[model samples]
Target chain A: MEKKIAHFTIDNKECTATTGVSIINAARENGIFIPTLCHYEGVKPAGSCRVCTVKVNKRHLTACTTPVAEGMEIEVDTAELNDLRSSVIELLFTEGNHYCPACEKSGNCELQALAYRFGIMAPRFPYQFNERDVDASHPKIYHDHNRCILCKRCIRIIKDEKDLPAGSQGRSIFAFNQRAKKVKIKLDDRLGKELSDELAQKAMDICPVGSILVKETGFKTPIGQRKFDKEAISLDNSINLKAMKEAHHE
Target chain B: MSKPVIATTSLAGCFGCHMSFLDIDERILDLIELVEFNKSPIDDIKSFTKDCDIGLIEGGCCNTENIHILKEFRKKCKILVSFGECAIMGGLPAMRNDIPVKECLAEAYLSGPSTVNEEGILPNDEELPIILDKVYPCHEIVKMDYHLPGCPPRADLIWEVLHALILDVDIDLPYELIKYD
Candidate 1:
């Protein structure tokens, strides 16, 4: 069956997308970058973080979860939206003990990148200074609750594929056991011991912040050489978009 | 008109922010031309001799002395800037906020690995400033007009803010200039 395509307008630009596609992915397909923290490629959108909140027909809705509809009008880059997004970033900073200077993910952290994009000099809200624990029980990955934005990327991305047939078909074999109000990314003890280095790296990469880190190796990249040091995150994306536009022109 | 008077001080911090300010290097000559130092370690000035236009404060208030100096800065300076992570959000010193004051004292003086006092002596000199229960960001103690967040705020950031303030121009802080580390 042919998928029904929906026509929409985002930030006054006309956008056409499949009916079931989330607004964020649709915007991305059209080269319109909507800043997000929790939303990851290929993972189910949780809409836990409101960083990607946008006005849909004059009402606030998370772009990551909201499906693109026919003739839907969306506002992404309004001043009010930017201010609201900045406030969310600030609240996340204060709520967690984010000592960026000492953190392993100082340069590459998405949270810090968002702060830089928003020009957040300081959080308007008072710092909570909540004491959180670090879990280094796993041999490969260490989880620092202090830096976790509760994005649930780890919880959602890593999954069990034990029931599937062996070989190329049985790649995914991890599970997360978390409860409401108290969410934690858990790995089975036996599976954790036998977890491949690739999977461990995947977990670290999936995390937007510096919450999950690989043990035995850190600070490998120097200060100036690190990601988001020479250029901002969005700058790279915009550059790519520009290059693509130029290619199309040619 | 006279050059803008700038005052600076380190409170409960390690003076790393001051060091980063010094990282401005040759820009100091330009800064000198733009603004005059007052009651700053740059000139070894002991106290505020006159009303200042700008005050760059490092670190948070962890002791009575910090509170006193911060209050004085609020009174003397027209604009107070929290100059680093310590001043903006309590920084490394804020780690003790989780622990009780008594435990912190015990860890530092009596039961610490570095402690050599057999008498379990905790410094209680009358001349010494009393320690606050917990370290506090400068904004909590006094109204802060601006904040430059970093362990030691980036040198370019300090220079840019100073330059903007002195020239009476709007500051357009670039992404590279506004790092937390």
Candidate 2:
């Protein structure tokens, strides 16, 4: 079946994408950048982080979840939107015990990158410093709850593909445990046993924060050379994995 | 016109930020030429001799003494800059913020593996500063004019801010210089 095309304007720039494509994808197709924290490729958009929020017809909408409509007028990169994004980043920083200095994911973490991009000298909100648990049960990785932003990318991404998967979806390796305020990502006790080194790296890579970390890989890259350390996270290209690998190898 | 006077103090910090400040290298000569040091650890001044044009505060408030000195700096300095991650958001010391202060004191003095308190005393003395319930960033205790965020706030960034503030110019921080780690 032929797919319909949707044309839209993002920040007054003409953008076109296939129908059902999210605003973020359409913007990306047009080389227009919409910053996101929780949004990841090949996974369903959760729209939990709210970092990708954009003004769609003067109303706030998550760019990753909202499909681009014909003649849709979307506002991105305005002062209001930038301020809103900055506030979200700040809120995350304050809400979590993100000790960037000691964190293994310091230079590579997307949350820290966003904070840097926004020029967040200090968070306006008071630090919560809530007590969080760390899960070292997994052999390949450890989960530091203090640094988590509750993005749920891991919960949505990591799956038991080792089994004969019926379709695109597989048994979830990570899931949300507990309820509001106490909500956190939990690694599947049984399925997590099959977690390969490659999957472990992927989990750490996709986390956007230092919450999920591969064992024995702490501080692999030195300061001033890690991902997002030399280059600011631009709108078009975010979290360059190849460049990060090159840095790690070097 | 008289040179702007500067005062600096470390509250709950590791003095790493101050070390980074000195990491300005030969710029120390330039900094001295640009400003005068007043009540600062570098000068060994115990009390403020006069009102300071700028005050650099390192670390957060973890004790009663930190609060007292921070308030004193707020009173004495015209423009106060919270220096480094500790002063900005409690940093590593804040890792214990979730645990009870009693637990912390116990671990430090009474119950920890390395601790050797013969009498099992918690060091409750009037001479010792009273510990607060939790670590607090400098801004929470007092108004701050600016904040430099980093483990040690990259010496170049500190230099830039100093230059801008001293010269009364806007800070044009390069993308690379503004890092949180």
Q: Top model by TM-score, which number?
A: 2
Q: Give me the runs in candidate 2 sitting further than 4 Å from their true place.
A: A240-250
Which pairs of residues clash in candidate 2, taking residues 3 or more apart in a chain or in different chains?
none
lDDT of 1 by residue, A97-169 (tens): 8988889989888888889888898898988877777889888888888888888777676655565666533
- TM-score per model over all chains: 0.92, 0.96
Candidate 1, position A130, lDDT: 78
lDDT of 2 by residue, B47-115 (tens): 999999999999999999999999999999999999999999988888889999999999999989988
Give the range of the ten consecutive residues with the poorest summed lDDT in model 1 chain A.
Answer: A235-244
Every model's TM-score on chain B: 0.97, 0.98
Off by over 4 Å in 1: A162-184, A235-250
| Model 2 whole-model lDDT (C-alpha atoms) | 0.89
Candidate 1, pairs of clashing residues: A159-A174
A66-134: candidate 2 lDDT, tens digit per residue: 988898899999999999999999999888788998889988889988888888889889888888989
C-alpha RMSD of candidate 1: 4.0
